[model samples]
Target: MKCINNEFLSADTYKLLKLAKAKAKDINYKYAWVHKGMVYMKKNDDSSKIIIRIEDDPTCMSSNLKFLSLNVNSYTAHTASFELLVTETKPHIISVVETWLNPEISVSLNDYSAIRRDRGFTDESGRYVRGGGVLCFIHKSLKSKVLFISESNHINHPEFIIADVTLSTGSHMLISCIYRRPQGDLLDKFFLEFGKLYPHYNNVLIMGDLNCNLLKSDRASNHLKSFIDDSALFCVPFGSTFHTLETDSWLDVIILVSKDKLVNFSKSKPPFIDGHDFLICEYKLGSQNHYNKVVKFRDFRNCNHQALSQTLNERLRLTDIDPEMIDLDELVYFFLYQVTTSLNIYAPMSERKICRPKCPWITRELKLEFHERDALYKRYKRTGCQNLFSLYKIKRKELKIKLMKVRNDYLKSFLENESNGSNIWTKLRRVGIVKSKQSSPLDHFDADQLNKFYANILKKHLSCSRDFILNLPHLYSKKVNFEFNWSKIDIVDVTKNLQLTLQKSSGKNPDRLDLKWLKDHIPQVSLFLNLIFNRSLETGSFPEAWKSTKVMILGSNRKLKSLANIVLPQIIIDGNLIPYVNTTKHLGVHLSANLSWDFHISQFLRRLFTEEDPEIRRSDRLAAKNNISFKMPNFATTTYEHSFVVTAIRLWKDLPPEIVNVLSLETFKVKLFDFLISNE
Candidate 1:
């Protein structure tokens, strides 16, 4: 039997191992069941009546308030690894520096909402200075509100992102994620900015990769020390060596005010996604949010469908129908109530935990490989052996390859299963596979420029010209060959069609209603839609809500516009000419005005648009020429692969001709998009 020492294991694993060893001895067992880095030793042979209890380990306990900070050199390559760590660790808040994220590439995680201040702001010359960004990821359950900071107030602006947090305990915490470049006078300016903000928050946490070596008693270090002294901030001592990388110097640091407010401050091994180690801390500031399990009356696999139909029929018979007409809203509400009540009576409510599932791709082999890689890294760090370091690097590369394979396998299986009609959508909702965006380079225009550009677009495309509108009556009187029957649109058929087209799980619409809720109450919604259509036909007018238009801006060379102007002679939304953007999402396929795929490429090659960055280009050249052994940033790697165009075309080709040819443009846009996106 092989014996593993506690030195190589994590604190939690060590405690579990000790308990397992004792239990195995008590049961006189020669071996223990080891699976996925956990030891499952039976206490007795009678498995059914076995005594199962272990002492509570503080290291294994979940923290009410947890924070993780990492100096990710570039987040593009390591987003999957970072998400895995965050999911497993279950941190409440995460701070990342040197993110190198841009508007084109989205790094948003499922359970986490991102607040990113990316680098590469274009100057007057339309050139970019690309390399420093700060970002933060807060769990959606935290209910954290980000406070906007005015960057113009500071004369010397260092890269930083600050957020004011109101914890569950009702305590206030100010978190600042910063990145200080090791250049001229920037560190001094950072210290000044820090001093100015330190006095504002009572419980402040300052985390960053401040490139100054604290071990060296230099002027910058001394100044940092002076600021720490003045601000009454306590710099937590690293439990291990201060160095995070192979440089033998410490760069990453964490400083916080109020020692009593924090606990369990420690550093993790290098995550292998980046060169820097992850700093983890837990602060008991506020009460934990009470996650009350919502009781939903969902149909189970063995639900009595026959009984449900019979009960609904009997209930409908019991109701006395009036000969006179009722209000449209009342009729719709009563129909929904009947359907919902019948379903609830047939299928009782069940309490399900609102927990995100683990990544389906994370296999036991992957866990063992990750553990082995971390062990090798620790050994190399301890012994400083060239051979050990070489082996570690090899293992690191192999681990990356393994991760890519697992992700690819997962994606392949997911798409295949979903295409063949599988209930894998529930898991897909929790861990949606993030794909790199594929499109042409967006335009670089300021807010004023974009407003002007979109105003013109709206006028040309959306609004009718004066001459065209004046001639509309003449054209309208000349009836076309097309004819329609409003009565043929059965309410039940429309309801079923809408329900079939809905996404399994997605965010709320502008009306603040989820697809699932709409599906369950589709009859009422369909009746309401029927009433609205009839009313529109009778009065030749649409509802105010239906008239509101939300514009989505896409295409090449687009800037991050705050607001778009729309001024037309005949356009009005909600009794106003200037309509606001209701909802904006970043994902689409581009087509020319003539509906030709001429400009669109099959592959979303990230390298195509990024070739202009000198830093990235230079790094890639150096790595190729010298066969660099160190970890390269995301930009240095030339392995960008995406088959979005191929998959999309294949899916579209698979659709039946009858369905494809008959679907209207608006219907295809909403329903086809939902189907493709949900499957993806």
Candidate 2:
């Protein structure tokens, strides 16, 4: 028998070997192989019921049986080359043999020579030189009775072989053996194919040299993202596994299915090969003998076993500690009580949701009150004040003095005014001002009031001084820090001089009066003047001196009179006229000429006619007396007499359509006023 490529051994295997040696006398075995040809044995263990066998080869029957018997039985069995072939009679024995060899060598052992007896390998030039194929076997297990074989035929494509282990537990396992190309687009094709293949398996355990890093590749990441979008399977949380000593990257994984079943499984460190690590999983198969049995296996030895167990324990602990199962309302109430007690305040009612009374405000209030209470309690405790009332009085007196300073500072502006007095009555009045209220006389004159009389005396003196300074124009101006010297001349005289200077500069013409300039130089004064003039006009009480002068002086300046006639007439009429009259007719002819022709025609007609009917002879005589042209009518046949026809025809021919429309509209009151006034 030959076994090849035995490279590594585990520490537990050594212990097992030692145990085998100690039991060697019972087995009566002479020797056993440790690894590929490194054999050791005890001469006395030939009769041993169990034996230790370790080898890398799968085709050797002796080695395979020894490996199986060690796991199935306790006693050591030493055999040099024992072979017991059984037909149907010893089926159990045959079953055991089959179990051992089936897992170990089914995929690896091939009778290719039988199929190609005359074939030989080809030389470099393609002539036949040698004819053989590479073969390898893989075993994957996920759950009970879930096992599979992956075989590489001719060192190329790996084919998954289904086993006939029908599980009573209704569990199915998936196994995929991937032998990737060295470099190509083959990875994309492999993943595309795997996505289609994955849905068929219930429990998948894929293992092999996939030659692909799932983490570093974008396509792999995207595929994993898609896989996780469904919550059925979860990836294990081992950081990295393979390529232990290589600097580039590690963890070419053997992915598992029904991942929640193996949730606590993890990878072992210090790879099986020095440069390639493998995962160890501790999975719960099912309940056995009324207790859970965790099956742990690792592809690597000499790795941390405790980590795997710890991972399992943590997962169990998390499941046990999940807080979602607790009653949340009770938890919230308890937390509320905790916060309220810490704050030394009552918790807010559950119905109130704005700013909760149980918030940081309560905490801050408690902190402040505690500081105050601590000081008072210390003082009362030191003073030996027996009654609560007496202790409170003491604390209140102390607090009152401290708080009085704060109140004084708050009212310092009102108190510091020279006109005000710092006394009970004045303080009450000051408080009223702060509260925005009126003062009372009893607040000053009460006999029991502290400093009441003095406060009243001071207030009276302040009132008199205020009035005196107000009456004194110089002092009033001084108070406002104005440069005007009121004592040098009467304030009225100074104002009159300023007005006269303005009027002279304005040249008795409203058009030349720079209202903007007046506003800039003396905004308050100008505003006051305008207000007075407007109010007088509105009340029909405008002083005849100003009004007459305004009209006459404005009429003297053609530009001023034109502006006043057009703009100011409307302003005055809109402001004061209960039943307005035509002011434009009152305007001089030069002002009337500036009016629109509609005003000229309407004014002329109103002035010319007063009654509905007129004597033709009288109209004709009047037209002749006014030096206006007239035409006499020959009314021998009709009662209607046509007189003043020449004047009427002349006026009708001169009137424009705009003038006609203006005369026709009854609501055109301003137009009527302008026309009548201009005609007058």
Candidate 3:
């Protein structure tokens, strides 16, 4: 170590700082120790002096931490792929470099919150640099804030985005995403800024595509090598990240230096296929925020539906234990017991931790195709064969098409069959058509607070509802159709309605009323449910479990943070003016203003307004595109043959393009029959 003076440090035009409890700490001045994001190295340099910072003895305050670093050339263009990465993969912090974003361009992900620094800022020459930027996508559940952003006047200066994220144990971790151009002398510039920021935060993780490959013997590589001399920080020993036909190099790196131990870690292959293979490190940071609810789920894929049906049919012999032979309640109870017992034997519930969003659309075939494409790419990269590269590109394009088709098919099937507004919105939200804002940090309101606030307004109505027996008799006295009445609805009708209800999982359910289980065993449960419902109505009593039919009080709420800036004039009723508050509750719905209520219910109102009588024959299957004229299966001797064949061909032609291209005659026949039966 040289004398702690200006001349020693001024030897380089740029510099960086680092972490170490070394003998060089005995120095004065704020910029006393040289920062360590860069280095200088020669081939013959002494190997013993190169202080490796792997921290063989682990020390850490965090319980669970995972980071994914990628050099996404442009995040905006690849957002759909990136969304899959963030949601499917469990990463606490996602660091992306080379985002190629600008101020006017907006990027939003459903569950992950983004902090981006675009390279639009002017350099020393007063011209904006075209294509380098850095960003971090922190999971929404974590408490985080932007700590610093690097804005150097030099055009070739390294770009950085720094964030301090708080773990569940309330320990803060400084995350930095850095990106540097492959230019000259910028190593010093990068480390100079990084050096100044490193000392303040103890728990630090630096990730980026810094363009200086440490494996190479060059001036920039030497600079990085010298930077690693400090004992506190270490770059992960990752193999060649950036891959091409003729070259493979470690241009991307994850450099971490923290006081806490992070020894228990693992890496994963990134979901997306790109030139730069992403670096994923799953770290045991600290205590994890236990938010994911452990739910009991039966693997229906393994369950034999036919066996379940046969068992139920054999067990419920109506003649032996018929309604005439036994009491209604006893018969119902017996049927329920038999059904539940059969289900228990067939599809028993097993506890599973939800690690990712449910993507049932990602069928086994699609997943296999995805893996095969990845394999092709990896093989092409390894062998550098032109034919393999061509095949990889073809597979990649085909896979993209299939992915889109599968997702669209999932949505189509859902929307066509399910009409429940809440379930529809839930699906849309999950699929990301609806924007999901991060849960507000400032929200302190709870159920009790809301209840107390509403109680005050309710006090004025206390005098209006004292006599319930006299007022409640009108509903019982009025005559109603026997089929539609609550006292004696048909079991068939109840079962039909239940079929339309979306399947939902339940937790802490004492009665074990999982909607999925009920739906799966619907045929067996219909008679039992009908009997119970009729019994309840006849007895003028409600089952406690069924009382939960009321809408959940904590209905989905839109993020209120965006409404903070909205200020409206006071409402004047007669001569008195009523002051406006931040949130106004109308019929249990939180809204910003009176006019917002209009916007809130506008969809419903629009439907009502535009409700002209639709045509009885709404479907134009015959008019759809590529309406092929079908040969009558060599039996076009009657009107039935002409109408049926033509209609079937039209429908087949109108199917999704990929589906039409690959559909077999047998599948088309089966689909056509089903369509005819459904329409009938």
Instruction: Give the range where candidate 1 is weakest over 10 consecutive residues by summed lDDT.
Output: 594-603
lDDT of 3 at 138: 80
Local error of candidate 2 at residue 86 (angstroms) = 27
lDDT of 2: 0.34
Kindly list the per-residue Cα lDDT of model 1 for residues 378-495, writing each as its tens digit.
Answer: 9986789989999999999988998989889887877776752334554554465442343321233343443444444434434223354233333322111222223434677667
1 against 3, candidate with superior TM-score: 3
TM-score to true structure, per model: 0.32, 0.22, 0.33
> Per-prediction count of colliding residue pairs?
8, 31, 27
Sort every candidate by lDDT, greatest first: 3, 1, 2
RMSD of each: 26.1, 41.8, 25.9
Q: Candidate 3: where is the Cα deviation over 4 Å?
A: 1-296, 300-338, 351-373, 376-424, 432-443, 446-448, 462-487, 490-511, 515-523, 549-680
Candidate 2's displacement at residue 19, Å, is 20
TM-score of candidate 1 against the unseen true structure = 0.32
| lDDT scores in order | 0.56, 0.34, 0.58
Considering summed lDDT, which 10 consecutive residues are worst modelled in model 2? Answer: 66-75
